[model samples]
Structures are given as C-alpha cells and as structure tokens.
Target: MRKINKYILILAAGVCFTGCTKFDDDINTNPNKPAKVSGTQLIANSEMYLPGIANNAYGSLYPQYLANTTYIDDARYTTVNFNFYSLYYGPLMNLESVINSKTLDGNEGPVENQVAVAKILKAYFFWHLTDRWGDLPYSQALKGSENLNPAYDKQEQIYDNLFLLLDEANATLTNSTGAIKNDIVYGGASLSWKKFANTIHMLMALRLSKVNENKAKTEFNKALNAGIIDNNAANFVYKHLAEETNENYWYTSYTRQGRNWYALSKPLVDLMQGTADPRLATYADKNAKGNYVGLAYGLSDAVKVEEYSLLGSNLRKQTSPVYLVTYAQALFAKAEAAKAGWIPGGDAAAETNYKQAIEASVRQWNNNDVTGLDNFLTQPEVAYTAAEGTRKIATQRWVHLFLNGYESWSEWRRTGFPVLAPAPNNNNKQIPRREGYPTQERLNNTNNYNQAVSSFPYGGSDNLDARVWWDNPNK
Candidate 1:
C-alpha cells in the first residue's frame, strides 16, 4: 500500500511539471515582436545623408552654371565626378541593405516602422536616380545579400514601382497600432509621413508630365486631392545642429581646407543682383570690400587668383538645413503644372501661385520676413505674361531651387529653364543628363554596366550635353 502511494505521488509531480512548462510556452508566444533594424540606423547613425546629399546637389553640380573650381571647370565637362557618384550610390547602397534583407527574411507579422521608413527613403532615392539617370536598376538593384548582381530596369518601370511602394508606405504608416521611433525628418509623425509621401508624388508627377502627361495629371490630382503640404511648416527638412559633428553640409565643406573649394557663380549672383533678391545677403557673405564675390567657371588659374572670389561652399554652414523637399518647391511645381495645362488652372492663378512660391522661397531664406516681398513680387520680369511660356514658370522654379543644384539641374534638363550657357570647351557641348555608372559598378558589374551603356544614345559616354529620355529637347 505504501509503495503504491509513492508511485501515485511521482505521477502527480510529473503532471505538475508538464502543466508549468505548457503555461510558460503560452506566455512566450507573443504575436508582436520588436523589429529587426540595421539599415534604417544608417540614416540616424550620423549627419551623413543630409549634408552628403545637399553638398553634392547644391554645392557642386547646380553651380556648374556659375562655373567654379570644386567642380569641372572645362567649357564642356563630362565624366562622373567623385562627389556626384558618392551621393548617387552611398545612401542607396546603405538603405538597400535594410530593405532587401527584410523582404528576403520573410518574418512578417506586424509591420516594422523602420522598414516603412526605409521604403519611403528608398522611393525618394530612386526618384533622384531616375531624374538623374533616366534608366537604372530598380526592382532588383537592392537585394541585400540575395542576388548580388541585380539587373537594371527602365525608368518607366521604376516609376510604376515607386508609386506602388509609396502607396504601401502610406498604408503602413498607421502609427495608432505602434509608433515609429527614429524619424529624424518628421519626428515619427505618421501624418507628416503621409504628407511627405503625397508631396513626393506630386513632385514625381510634375517631373514626368513632359513624358507621360496623362499619368502625370492623374498622380498630381491624387496628391492634390489627398491634400499636399500647405506651408513652410510642412517642409521636409533635416535640421542641422551647431555642433561641429552636426554642422550643415556647407559648413563642413567650407571649413575643411582641401574640401573648401566651391563658391557662388556669376550667373547666380547676377540673377539675385538683377532681381534685388534679399536672400542674396543671407545666401552669400560680403567680402572685405562688401561686394558679393564668386568664381567664374572655366577660368584660368591666373583669373581665379585675380578674381578674389571663392567657390560657394556657403551651404556648408551649421545653420544650413538639409532640405529633402520644400513647400516652396512643391508650390512652384504646381504652378508649372497648372501653366502647362497639366492640371485645371489658368495662367493668372498659376502666376499667382508662382509669385507665392517665390515669396515662400525668399521668406524661407534665413529670416521669415515678408518685408520687400511685395515689391519683389511686382518685378516686371516675374509678373504674368502669356508670351513668357514655360520659360518664366521654369525660371522662377530654378530660382527657388537655387541652393539645391541637383534639382535645379534636373529641372533645367527637363524644361530648359534659366537658359544656361553651354560650356565653351564642352567635349560633347551638351549638359550631362545622367551620371555614369560608378567605378565600382564598372569593375564589379562590368557586364551589366556594359549592357546598360549600350542602350544609351551617345555610346554611353558621360557627355555634359547628352539629353536623357525625359528631357523634352536640346535648347
């Protein structure tokens, strides 16, 4: 009877242990898991993207119109410079790792906020890529560890995919369920991300209006209907801190001796001078003589010394914000679209919006002053004239995009605005439509690069004036 009791007791103990193990397993099976992040950290890791993108776009290329040292000085310059290539590949490559890994890992339950941000950033980067290069690797380009050599996709296809991604991002940004943590641009505000997504769509549509009018109009209407960014408050800018490590792109470039090479060009200075644009004072500092000084592009060594002008690295200041997109730019794009009849609006309304865009841009300069803005608005050149055609609209857009050289250059290529002069010694004598594949790409993906180049119109040479597919025609 005692032996029988001992066996029963042992069985009871085993049953209790099994029950405890099952309870612990049930507790551990949580549906909501913390997101795995590696690439999104790259954006917040340092002040890299903000300054890096700003420096290349505003600091180097757009000022090509002004002709300065830090960039190519030959009358006709071709070939991808280091700065240009770096901006093109650096951010994309980093973001790609995060995106490709997440998709391939296939561990989806609840959506990761960082993954959504990565998608949005990826879309933004691709927008730049398409605007610059026309056709490039899109769907397969950023496969992380999977598929090392991704094939290139046409620009049209890329745009289609981009639109899809933006839609998904908009849907995924529902933060009511869970919040996005490290959003440096919008502070994890899902509403702001939605606005950013819509605004970017508008810009993208405007860019494609020349090539695909119907598609552009449709996208524009969608963005407008969805409600785009209304004012400067909604501008998508990455704020820079005064700290040396956190200094703006301009400050970093100008303060560093070897890197402190660029300056404002004569064309840019002349434009401000002619318009009496107040922002000039803030954009550039006066020399000892109180004159707005800048270097002329394509100048000889002796001329540069005599000029007493430096390249425009003023954008490198710690105060300078890295503007991913601006309310002013969006307004200007809308005005252009309206004038082009890409949307339902008249010239008067478009001109009003154009002037407003200019005002917004000037007001946004350094100080948010409305003083002198009215007088500046009334300038005969800026006022509405049907004969002005798209030139007027595009030129004003160019002015607003002044500090942002890459966008300015892209717009100029698209619309032939601001009537830039061809480089006197231009090898191809054409403005560069797109940067060539990076040296690494050439070395690593030689076959793919060669195949892509073969499809280019000018034998794949990085000619300054080679027009991309979207550029309407050579002026």
Candidate 2:
C-alpha cells in the first residue's frame, strides 16, 4: 500500500510540474504573431471596396434623370454637402500600403504578378482621381503616412504616367507566370490580364484624344495591336455573391433603406422607349399596374409621391456582373478612332465596327446570347448607319453603359453624348465640372488645397463646371 501511494504521488507531482511549466510559458512568452497576410489578401480587400466607391460616384452626384428612378431631388440637394474627396483618397491610400509593403507575410515578398496587379489597380484609381478632381497628387500621392501632404501633379503629367504604368502592366501580364491566388476576377489567368491591360490602354487613349491626339493615336494603335477583350467572357468584372455583405453597391440604397429613391430619367427612358430597345425590359421592372415608370431629373418635395415610380426588381436584385471594361467599349473606341481617320478604316468599316460594338454591349447585358439581337439590329434607330459620326458611336456607348453611372458620367464628360438638360435647380445654374476638395483638406492639407484651388480657371470655386485639362478642346 505504501509503495502504491508513493507511485501515485510521483505521477501527480509530474503532472503538476508540466501544468505549471505551460502556465508560465503562457504568461511570460510573447503572443504568437498573426499569420502573415499575402499580397493576394491585400488585393482582395482592395477589390472588395471598389463597388462602394462606384456606387457613390453615380448615386450621390450624378443621379439618374429618368422619371421612374428615385432620389432625383435628394441627390441634387445633397451633392453640395456630400464628402466625395474621401472616395478618391481612401481606397488609393489603402492600396498604396499594400503596394509599398515588401512582404505580405513578412517573409515571402510580393511577386512580379502581384506587383503588376497592384500597379494596374493604382492606375485605375488615379484615372478616376484625375477625371473627378482635374489635378491631384500622383507620383507623390501614395507614400503612405510618410508623405501626408503630397503636392498635386498636373493632369497632363498624370496621363503620361498612366500610359507608362499601363505599358508596364501589359509587359508584366505577358511575362509573369505561376498561379496568382486571390484573383477573384480571372483566377490569375494571364490571357485575361493581358486583355484587360490592353482594354485599359484603349480607354486611356480615348480619354486623352481631346488633349493629346498624337499620343492618343499611338497608344490606341498599341492597344489594338496588343489585343482587347474578345467578348463578355473576357470582360473585367467583379461579381457579387448575393448576400447582404456581398450585395451590389447600391442595393440597399435602391431597396430597403430608401425604398423608392431612384427612377429612370426622361431622356434615357425616352431613348430606350422611343427606339423600342429590349434592354429596357431587362434594366427596369413593371410597376404594380404593370406600367414602366421613371422619375424626373430634379424633383421637389411638393411633387406627388405617385409621380415617382420605383425601379424594377431587375435592377434592385440584379446579380449580373459589374463591368470594368467590355469588348463593346473597345469596339466603340475603334469606331471613334476610325471616324477620326486615326485608323486605316473608312466610314463603312467604322459603321460595321460600331454596329458590332453596339451588338456586343447589348449581348453582354443579355447573358451573351446573340439570338434575337440580329433582328433588333435591322431597326434603323438601333442600327449603325455609315453616315453617322462619333456622336452615333458615343450615343450607343452611353446606352450600353447604363447602370454603370460612373463610366456613363465619365463618358458624358469626355464625349458629351446623349446630351442631357442642365439640372433645374443647379446651385450655380452650371453643370458640375468636378467635385470640390473635401472640407478636411482645409484642416489636413490646407496649403496644398489652397494652391490647387487658386490655379483653377474659374477661380477654383466648387461650383465651376469647367472642363479638366485633358477634357478641354485642344487636341
């Protein structure tokens, strides 16, 4: 019995000692560092935030002018008060961190492919920044916390840099190899990246056409030679997963919270309705009485509630892809280039390409099924006639870009297609040229903001709608 008791005591002491050792280790040892994140993870977070940015671009400032859409009045009223500067600064700032940070995992650094993706994304954000605010910080913008008061670069210089960055991205896409994890769009497919890079090149060239014809033509030719998106399958898009967390950017704004905030504008609806466009059915929904309805561009509170029809469920619950660039847009760009005699193609060829581009955009919206589109193409209003100029091509492009308000707004600023009436109650009775610097700029970077505003053609006032450097009539 004594022997047994002694053995048991020994076993208990050993157990106690082990437990004490573990407790000591837990109390005194540094906590395990979190698993190092990857460049792909950083990219994923950046991609995830894009929809919100896009939503704010269209919904807040450039509200739809259609009759059945919602928030026409509210959008106009709030535009002056909304803080859009954050939209430009926030995402780009975060992405800058990911771009500069050497190792996502603190051990394994970013690869060539990761760097290429980051550069492309950076260019995209800068494109929006320049388009919206004219001149903004470029080379010095994303130095993380180290350069908080970076000086603004001219829009012309920014465009030059965009071309350079895009060239680098194209080269990287062509050469980089191995699987790219967290590539939610293309699954790290090099071919798709190449196509997207070329598409962006084409877009940038067209954007610069008004300012730098020679450079625009050179880039345009380069993009065409490199190749563009072949079809909807190769489109650059970010798909939403249908859950609230992954829901479309304006889903809540159009649905539960606002209820009936936006409706189609009269001009847009008239264009679709007058031409008997099939996309109207796909884009909008029938009301309780089965009638299609839209809202006026600027509505006052005194307006009757029944006058504003809610947007159809088609748009409200739309799970279709959100486009970054499409083959149709490339075709339209080709048509525009051809119309300007920048390309070897003549009017007939340009018309053919324009028609194809229009068809491509329509087909993309219709799930890439080209079945009935051919018949629709026979209609004179819907078809491309050889006599038409850049206006025709641009008009069709605008229609295809419907629901993609930021792209539409940008296109309008670029081409002035689908001519819209001035806002009835525009504060300055002038169209907004660009969003103002955020009020926070006064607090955070007052000197820089003051310098930028002082250089503006219209006294750099917030209300001026003067075209940006690249958008003005020069080239």
Best by lDDT: 2
Alpha carbon lDDT at 138, candidate 2: 73
Q: Give the TM-score (vs. native) of candidate 1.
A: 0.82
Instruction: Estimate the overall C-alpha local distance difference test score of candidate 1.
Output: 0.64
For each candidate in turn, the TM-score is 0.82, 0.85
- 294: Cα error in model 2, Å: 3.0
The regions of model 1 sitting more than 4 angstroms off are 1-47, 57-59, 62-66, 69-78, 81-90, 93-112, 175-179, 258-260, 302-315, 426-428, 457-465
Against the true structure, candidate 2 reaches a TM-score of 0.85
369-455 in candidate 2: lDDT tens per residue? Answer: 665676667666767766656778888888887666666677777787767766676463544556666677778888887777777
Writing each residue's lDDT as its tens digit, candidate 1 over 81-189 gives 3323454356676665555565422222224555566677878877876676666777776555676677777677888898888877776767565444344577656
Candidate 2 segments whose C-alpha is farther than 4 A from its true place: 1-37, 57-72, 75-78, 81-90, 104-110, 174-176, 302-309, 318-320, 369-372, 457-460, 473-475
